[model samples]
Target: MTNLYRSRAMQDAEMSNSSFLPSLPSELLFHILSYLDIPDLLSISRTMHYLRTISLDPLLHTYRLQRASVILSRAIPSRPPLTELMARRVYITRTTLTALNLGRSLTMIRLKRQLERRPTVERLIELGVLPPECYLNQSNGISTTLGLYRRRKVVQKEKVRNFLAEWIGELSKRITRRMIDSSRSTRDASSL
Candidate 1:
């Protein structure tokens, strides 16, 4: 707010602190502040005594009460404690939403299905869910070769990708089968 209609005390407070909220019109200040929670209003009070005085003014609250009386019948509680529901209800800003976006990828879906259950390394290798070189000798809990780097040479990136796609596809099918079986049981129970 500008210094045009500011009182002597407000002008002095403004001069003392460089914490001015720029561009907010003085006329709208009270209206905006009224909507804010008690903690926020208290914080604002620390910035300027003028705001504190205005926030504490019984006249303002009385006016709010009178206005609210016409709209709301029940005394609703303030914000509830943070919970899963609260976290899920949060509105994501466009930038954050865009940054988080990873378009639906069939390869990832297929890979997730293929790797749904932690199968034996041998089984994984057999199903092409894991590259052949990634399979360790189960008896010793170590790779067949002493050279770990050499194993990487044998297991190319394309093989790994293919393995993942195969894994996810298998996992997806397993999940779908379980869902179908579950639905069939429910249907049978209802028929009985």
Candidate 2:
């Protein structure tokens, strides 16, 4: 009886899940996708492999671009500028970093003291007073002399940050290119 009940529950769950995006025809799906703003379309696209392929289709983006621009135009113009965004991030990181001090070891305290004696190039970059390109010259010199474990941990942080920044820049470029192309199509559409 327990096995029979389990089978019935599994069947019901499967039946329920079978009804999502997979049920829609591609043409109809694309039409539905057209109504979404760019961000929403991106999120929905991740729901399925086919949806991802279809959402990235140029024709669909033409519609999404128009929708996103319209949505953005309607949003409040008083939203905070880039400086506020950076400050908020710094505030959050600062607060969380202080919270992280509870788990500190002696080596970690020593590292913090070492970091304090370095130049303030990273802080300048964070504040937007200096560009990220200038930050490349500011590595803490002690990582080279540290033990293997310490070196790995110290070096890993910088490596991960560089990798993340590169990928983030790539993502920004792709988004900008798509928006530019969409704006052109929008112009063509209006001219028609």
Candidate 3:
């Protein structure tokens, strides 16, 4: 009789937990995700592959970009007319591109450091993100640096700003389009 009671209790526990395991709809998940702070979201995303994919939804990417822009706006110098594009270019490194977690903060520190430089043209050339032909003079020092190729992209502040503007604009547009498409699809599905 005790064995039978124990089995019955186990069955009841399973029944109670069954609905608890039901999958959350992606819409609800996204809503929840939006409410989470960036750090929390990043932590959750890094914990598992499934979550990482969800967090990387196109809309989420747009959200991250917007957040980065806000952070940049607050951090950059006010007087010199630093465009969002310029902030992005210097801040958005290869690693940061893949992960939104530390991208904006890291970019802020790097940008601040670069701005306090001696303000020379060579320093600018060294920091510029322009292609070799754009800023590097053929007879200049950067052209032949430590057994390097004749033409290499130099990342300067101005160049960085241009690159950031172009790349971020393209990305932002694509993300906007995706967001529009996703909403339309949801509306259609609900109406059906």
lDDT of 1: 0.71
Better of 1 and 3 by lDDT: 1
What TM-score does structure 2 among the candidates reach? 0.30
| Sort by lDDT, top down from the best | 2, 1, 3
Whole-model lDDT, model 2: 0.78
Name the top lDDT candidate: 2
Residue range 101-155, candidate 3, lDDT tens digits = 6777799889999887646555555677433344456555554442243323334
Error of 2 at 60 (Å): 1.9
Q: Score residue 32 of candidate 2 by CA lDDT.
A: 90
In angstroms, how far off is 7's CA in candidate 1?
23
By the TM-score metric, which is better: model 1 or model 3?
1
CA error at residue 26 for candidate 3, angstroms: 1.1
Give the TM-score of each candidate: 0.29, 0.30, 0.24
Off by over 4 Å in 2: 1-8, 16-20, 31-49, 76-192
Candidate 1: which stretches are off by over 4 Å? 1-32, 35-43, 57-59, 73-118, 133-192
Model 2: which ten-residue window has the lowest total lDDT? 137-146
Candidate 2 lDDT, 1-192, residue by residue in tens: 999999999988887784666777888988898987779977977787888899899988887788788888888586777678767874456656776675576669889999988768678778887555454443563322225546667798999999999999999999999999999999999999
Colliding pairs, model 2: none
